[model samples]
Target: MKKFWLLIVFVSILFSCSDNNTSNKNPYIPSYSVNLSIDMNLPAYSNLKFVSNGIIIPNYGAKGVIIFNAGSGYTAFDAACPNQALTSCTAMTINGINAVCSCDKTEYSLFTGLGGKEYPLKQYRVEVIGTVIHVYN
Candidate 1:
């Protein structure tokens, strides 16, 4: 009886576990390998030291990568507009804490990666080591 109960418990616990991995990838943007490190102390990246500020690093991801300082931590997203295909105007330009797409004037928030359209901005992983910010996918 004891052995049967143990087996039942083991089976129940095993069945309870699940893979909860979620991805914020948009279908329009191509997945690119990203492993960039930005030093906040550097003159070029100094603006990132303040909260709610972001910068676009060209020639990195689909169009590029936009790194944002989201107060509590940092976030990085693909510069390509999530709502549309890759075109000359697909690359978004930053407007304060938001990234605006010229194609349809769709606006996306840098802090949350949410946009007005169906697809949200594809997000990358971010890590901060002291003053240096590391972005990867």
Candidate 2:
């Protein structure tokens, strides 16, 4: 019957339109074969306040960010916004003790490595063995 075909068509369309929600896929984190060390007393370290290479590093295990301080220390974190993961703009800019992402202007505290405005920046583990900094996934 025409009504039966119409019903089937409507059901098919509804199922097709249903959100194909996929699980959050982990990002990739590059490996460093050589160990690197930076001196905090160096002029280059003291001169530059912030650095941006316009590159995004995936965490592999989860969404995160990594900040390397040649002079002082190294930091890593999850790039996903703590408040909400709906937006793709979770990357943040470091401003002293805070990291602010241009998208939504979400501010995260670098000191505590937590998100502000009811969200916190998920932090990763960092090991400083002398001048060498190790960031692991």
TM-score of each: 0.81, 0.46
How far in Å is the alpha carbon of 1 misplaced in model 2? Answer: 82
Model 2: per-residue lDDT, tens digit, 1-137? 99965664554344324343221122322222222243434554433234321112453323445444422334545555555553556455566546676667766644344454554455445566654444443
Q: What local lDDT does model 1 show for residue 21?
A: 16
Stretches > 4 Å off in candidate 2: 1-64, 68-74
Please write out the lDDT profile of model 1 over residues 8-108, one tens digit for every residue. 44532332231211335567777889999999999999999997789999988898999987766677888888888887565799998799997988888
lDDT of each: 0.78, 0.44
Scored by lDDT, the top model is 1
Clashes of each: 0, 10
